[model samples]
Target: MGEGVTVSGDIAASSDIRIDMWSKLGSRVEVGGNAYLGEFVTIDGKLLVEGDLDVGKEVKIRGGFEAKGWIVVRNPVPVIIFLFLYIREMMRLGKGEEIEKAVEELFEDSEDSQDFEGKEPSENIMIIPAGAKISPEVIEVAGEADIGSNCLLIGNIRAQTVETGKNLTLKGSVYSEGKIIIGESSTVHGNLFSKGQVHIGRNSRIFGGIKADSVLMHENARVDGTIKAPSGVSFLREAAEKQILVEVNALGKGIVSKARELPKGVLQDDLIKAPDVAEIVSLIKSSAKAKNGFVPGRKRKTARTQALERTRRFTGARTYRKEKSGD
Candidate 1:
């Protein structure tokens, strides 16, 4: 055969096999089927056969070539078939309708026939529904995407910037390459992870952990778990107040413990202070002035006297000063 010639069967030569140009083979070119090509041999043609083709150097082929018994080709058909099948299966599972349809058509007949007798028709076919919901394509960014209010998302979302508006709810996790913001009246049940900043608006509720470079909570916002950020953390006034209240409990315990640790003399010093009745009356007169825009007159004084008598029965304060002059 010529230098670029292609053969379908075996080619046996007594001398060395050499070709300056490309040489192709449609089928296996068996050299005695037992002894293959010598070392440093090259076959440019694609080899396809049920038998084996052994060679020393590289063998180039086009399309798919198969050697079932013992394949020594540079490119094997079985590997390509396996890879193709793997990709096909992946596409099918990815819900690609075109790929799924092609695969189904490849395995089943295209013609449709009515059921004969009482036998059920074959069910190898599948129909894609018209209203099938598909997940949204994820948009990834290195910066950020500010989500406005009242936005509807049907698919996965990923961004570097995520700013949610009031009354916004996402169906999926919010993965931010940078920062995230949940505005007022928003609710997020999914996880939120950001590399930069995370701000939860007032009246927002987050059921998942919040991680970012920095975290800020507005007034009345509620978080159920840990908030971790590298740079800074800001708490609302209400949250700070609650934290102060929590610390108050511990402070109360410390106060009781300190009192117990004190010596008898220190305890007696605390109990020796006498109640000042004149100062108490002056305080009441000031309070009455502030409430009634002036000091209490005769009628107001009579009301206060009655109130004091009622409180004295429950309280230990029994001393009373009637009028400015001590009585």
Candidate 2:
């Protein structure tokens, strides 16, 4: 029936015991015929079925299950399973179905095996061993990434979170949507972009520009290009004659701009430049076009409508002034 049942002892039914919608059984449940479970059902003990077993949404079994007939589950698949399916579908779409079939066959046996045996291993974390050389164009890791000390990773790294050991060298850029930690004496030859916080270790060097939500730089860390952060930047200890271009919208607790003269002894560089008005205007026009989905001839019509509105408002103001004078 469509009700909850709590059983202290084992129930051995001759025909069938159907546990339906929002029903929960406390102890062991055994069915001789077909067993049907609906949404949000929890079985604390063992569940055994001789004929068939069917499960609906959010069914939890704490112990074990043994079914002689068929077992059917109807619920949204897990997120991990969806990701695998999405990747397979994309591969099938990009490459031919034959290639997809071949790839499936290559790893078909891995579906049952618990361990990684002759299967392409998927890992969340990839650790580059020390003194190892990797020359891939892009290394994608699902989870945290650790680059061993003295290792050379010669490509772009896209990861959730990245940590580099001391003396590590990267030839390409690093793009992390999460926090990125640069180890001491590490060198990155390309640009670094992070949506989350960035920590630059002492004596580390970045030859390219950096864009992040927030940046923390240790003393003596050299950045050759500009550093831009929306939240702000902080220095652990000031280095002597540190020459780096920082877009200082806010410095420390006080706000300082490139327009005003910087404090005489705090910073050593005069890296302020006026904004390019022409370039700024061009960027604004391009942004407006993209936002409005403007076509060539339609743009002129919109502009004419805006101009006519302005003219009508001006003429109306003048006529209102004339009537007030006449009154």
Each model's lDDT = 0.55, 0.72
> Which tens-of-lDDT digit does each residue in 1-327 have in candidate 1?
223333333344322233323444444343322224433334444434444555544544444345555745343456569859876787867957766676676668543465523443322221112212123444343344556666555344566577767887765667877768888888776667888888889888887788788888886898877788889889766522111111123223311233334444454444323233131133235454365545655344577887988887656433433333465
Q: Could you list the CA RMSD of all candidates, in the order they appear? A: 23.6, 26.1
Scored by TM-score, the top model is 2
Task: Assess candidate 2 and give its lDDT.
Answer: 0.72
lDDT of 2 by residue, 149-245 (tens): 7777677887788888889899999989999999999999998899998999999999999999999999789999999999999988854454333
TM-score to true structure, per model? 0.31, 0.34
- Lowest lDDT sum, 10 consecutive residues, model 1, at 239-248
Q: Residue 10 in model 2: shift from native, Å?
A: 60
Off by over 4 Å in 2: 1-135, 238-327
